[model samples]
Target: MTKVWEASVRATHSFLSETSIQKIKISLPKILQQIPDLIIVEDEKIIAFMGISHQELEMLFVAPEFRGLGLGKQLINYAIKNFDVNKLTVNEQNPQAIGFYEYLGFETYRRTETDDAGNPYPILYMKRKEN
Candidate 1:
């Protein structure tokens, strides 16, 4: 799972410096341990995973090789159906992620100048549309 997370982040989070990536990598294990719902898709090895808590999608990552295969959508849809996941935060620099979430009916509700760690990277807070 750690390898998959690193690969996915390297592939998509171009805005993160190597130093920033390493810093996050150090704390990932703790973060993973804290999440209550860890949904994973595995085929021999873990291909993708998402964390859900209190109806919020805390994290989602697909192995770089498995992206664009609708796995992310499938996972989020499953979360919505079963776990009631609705809100999430995405890096503002990651337009691809923002677009993907928007395509799934999430709309930006707020913005933050820095990420949770107080980095310069901005974040977009989003919520799935109520229907």
Candidate 2:
């Protein structure tokens, strides 16, 4: 989690300052309370994880060293098949993530100026396009 978050979230999510990251680290227990379901990918060590609440994909992160290995797409595929997941939000600043989801047939349908946390970062709301 630390490796993936530092590589992905800390790198792309500008709204999260070092202070905010520290705060988030301390608040994991509280955050876990809201997440009813989670998906994890592990080998010798934990490679990635995702948190979902119903059809909404709340979180996903792949470790830096483990990215580009199709782990993320595989996880999303599992979510789609098992959980009927079709919607998720991404930070507008993370073009790589946007492209990945777009490659998987997700299309942005809404935009928000602030995230659910009321942060100033823009969020792109996306849903899978029907085949």
Which candidate number maximizes TM-score?
1
Clashes of 1: 0
- For 25-93, candidate 1 gives per-residue lDDT tens digits of 999999999999999899999999999999999999999999999999999999999998889999999
Count clashing pairs, candidate 2: 0
On the 0 to 100 scale, the lDDT of residue 14 in model 1 is 94
lDDT string for model 2 (16-36, tens) is 789877877777667766889
Inter-residue clash pairs, candidate 1: none
Report clash pairs, candidate 2: none
Which stretches in model 1 have alpha-carbon errors above 4 Å?
none
Q: How do all models score by TM-score? A: 0.98, 0.89
lDDT on C-alpha atoms for all candidate structures: 0.95, 0.84
Clashes of each: 0, 0
